[model samples]
Target: MSSIKVECVVKAHNEIGEGPVWEEKDATLLYVDIYGPSISRWNSLTKETERMSTETYVGCVVPRSSGGYVIGEGTRFAAVDWEKRSITTITHVDTEKSNTRFNDGKVDPAGRFFAGTMAVEVRPTELERKQGSLYALQPDHSVVKHLDQVDLSNGLDWSPDHHIFYYIDSLKYMVEAFDYDLQTGGISNRRMVYRLKEDEGIPDGMCIDAEGKLWVACYNGGRVICIDPQTGTRLQTVQLPVAKITSCCFGGKNYSDLYITSATKGMDEEALAKQPEAGSIFKVTGLGVKGIPSYSFSG
Candidate 1:
């Protein structure tokens, strides 16, 4: 375990703050409060945060190559112009599963948006039900269903070389790797690369570093850990001030800062009282590492 200083960058107290995307051109951080179903932007230079309420649960937001954002909202994907607060539909998926919504997603090296879904209301009885799936939205607006039977489809990213795709199905407590086809945006040869212990917390959202290590936010564990995916060995751990750490991404002047998002969605009043920082966005510096720039959606 490495002792690192964590600072709360935003204290908005989001019910479920999940996605954290850094826009370099604007020097701002973009994230979504899934429960609020709003997209927010925090300016690094001004220290001001602005939010735009959406009509659906906005799970993730990625900059679009054409200007604006490609957002995953509920079962539909839309293009959002933050400046004008306008949205246009791209497509709707898996309409049969009305209870599921997009959870976490990212733009691939080839500029395609890949995201997954989870049951909107996770209940004890639904624990064993495989009610989720993963999909990829191509540059031409076509959607592809890659995986089914996912209980909670949370994080997705690619290896530095773009040959391996790493993903998290939180309900399985495993981090999986697939042989990636960058040119075709296809994934195969799926295998488990890392599995969490019962005490390590449920794996939620994840991102890859410049050196190829995977940083995973642990829900209910109050920590973010660096794991070597090939060997399944833990490299470093960042203890957080609050539990329910939902997601993380690297963003800063040099891309060395690790931005973390957390949640207070299911916490009781007493739990929230103890961890007021829950649902706040946190940043960790001095790790002496950098992350690759996140890609933007081509369409």
Candidate 2:
């Protein structure tokens, strides 16, 4: 364990701040508050934050090559005009079920937008099982279902070589890897790459680094662990000020900074008072590592 400093860059105080993607073109960080039902952009240079309120839960937000942004919100994958704050739903799935919503996702190297869903109501031991699925919106704007019966489709990413797709279901308390087909946006040969102990908390959002290691945010564990996916070995541990750390991405110059997101959801007044920075956006430095830029949706 090496010494690293975690700074509270933004006192966001979101009920559930999740997705975080770096925008290199604008030098800003784009993230979503699932329960705040908002997408926000934090300018690293100016130390300012801009938020866009949405009508429903917004799971993830990413830059689009066509302009504006792409978000997996509610039950639809929509296109947003940030300047105008206009949202045009490109397509939707799982419409038959009203209790499921999109959770976490990212763009593949080939430009496909991938997202998954989970139940709307989740408690410690009470949950609606198998109500969600994973989906991909192709550059051509076509929808495809990759997996079903996903109770909690959370963090997802790919290997530096783009050959392996890593995913987390949260409830499984493990990370799964798949053989990725960039040309077709398909995944196969699923196998477990990493698993967490009961004390480690649920795995939430994740992103890969330049060295091909996986940085996984532990939702209830209060830390992020860097794992060598090849061997399921834990390499580094990043303790956070808040216990409900939701997601993270590497940003800043040379991609050396790890931008993390947390949530204030499910906490009582006593819990909130104990951890005032529960939902703040965090920046971690001195890890001596760098991450690759997030891919954008070409559609």
- Checking candidate 1 for backbone clashes, the offending pairs are none
What digit string (tens of lDDT, one per residue) describes model 1 on residues 78-169? Answer: 99998999998999987887788888999999999999988876641145458889999999999999999988888888999999999999
Worst 10 residues of 1 by lDDT: 120-129
lDDT of all the models against the reference?
0.90, 0.92
TM-score for each of the candidates: 0.97, 0.98
Candidate 2 per-residue lDDT, tens place, 49-159, comes to 999998799999989998999999999999999999999999987989989889999999999999999888765314798888999999999999999999899999999
Look at candidate 1 and tell me the lDDT of residue 280: 94
Candidate 2 colliding pairs: none
Cα deviation in Å at residue 188, candidate 1? Answer: 0.6
